[model samples]
Target: MTTTDTTATGLAHGWYALSLLHGRIEAHIERALQSGHDLSVREYSLLDVLSHQHNDEGGHLRMNQVADAVVLSQSATTRLVTRLEDRGLLSRYLCATDRRGIYTDVTDAGLALLAEARPTHDAALREALDRANEDPRLTPLVAAVEKLDGGPKAS
Candidate 1:
């Protein structure tokens, strides 16, 4: 094979491995959160993100920012917010200064659920990574994920 072809194949393999790792981790977390807290991965992520907002200026995120953070489209984020709102897990309000802008926040119940589910989420992630590490093909990617925190050792 030509050098260019070899490089492309290598990139493809790397991309596939990364995607597989992400999918496995997310699925594991999803199952744990759902069984323990009745929350899907996206819902948990949204609640966690909104829980970090503060009362300071620009502390609250707009719909677009939330969408970007959650890696979903704006419309999808809105729908998710609505679903959570219906569950009393989130609430939405107009931006005080910008009538055209709106913000979403995690309700007290949402915060409580997130707190309860966090351990489950973390445990599931660690378990998934540990299992993945057993496969030599996935071990390097797992190590990279472990190094994401910039720590000397994988936690």
Candidate 2:
């Protein structure tokens, strides 16, 4: 059975339900992040991803990795980085060891914004998940999301 398969045959119903859940959560988070932080979902996500970087070896992420983490294309990622840099929220510098590679990192302002927005993001997420959990269609998915047990491990 594939994701497109119907409820009687496969996972289309589940797949769509998950999509709806994601959309709702993202929308809610976006509104919260925007109204409170003046940042878009992608921007906030980029800041959050960059905030995870460190000074240790391999702690830095290349642009492609950043793009992949934020679910944006490389060009789109570069554009986003530029926008944030203009706002003093992010900075791009050449890799110390690899001149050909550029690294993007959260600026002090970016980290500050991310720290402030983290609570809003978490609250919005919990609120959205809670609301979705009330829906019969999404209840199981919510449980699955909150569950501690990892998916079946490979032998």
Judged by TM-score, which candidate is best?
1
lDDT of each model, Cα atoms only? 0.93, 0.92
- For model 2, the local distance difference test gives 0.92
What are the runs in model 2 whose C-alpha is more than 4 Å off?
A: 1-9, 148-155
What lDDT is reached at residue 54 by model 2?
Answer: 88
Runs in model 1 deviating more than 4 A are: 150-155
What tens digits encode model 2's per-residue C-alpha lDDT throughout 69-149?
999999999999999999999998999898999999898989999999999998998899999999999999888887855
lDDT of 1 by residue, 1-155 (tens): 99999999999999999898999899989988888889999999999999999999989999999999999999999999999999999999998999998899899999998899989998999999999999888999999888786537656
RMSD of every candidate to native, in Å, equals 2.2, 4.7
Candidate 2 has which clashing residue pairs, if any?
none
The Cα error of candidate 2 at residue 150, in Å, is 10
Error of 2 at 90 (Å): 0.4
Please tell me which predicted candidate would have the highest lDDT against the true structure: 1
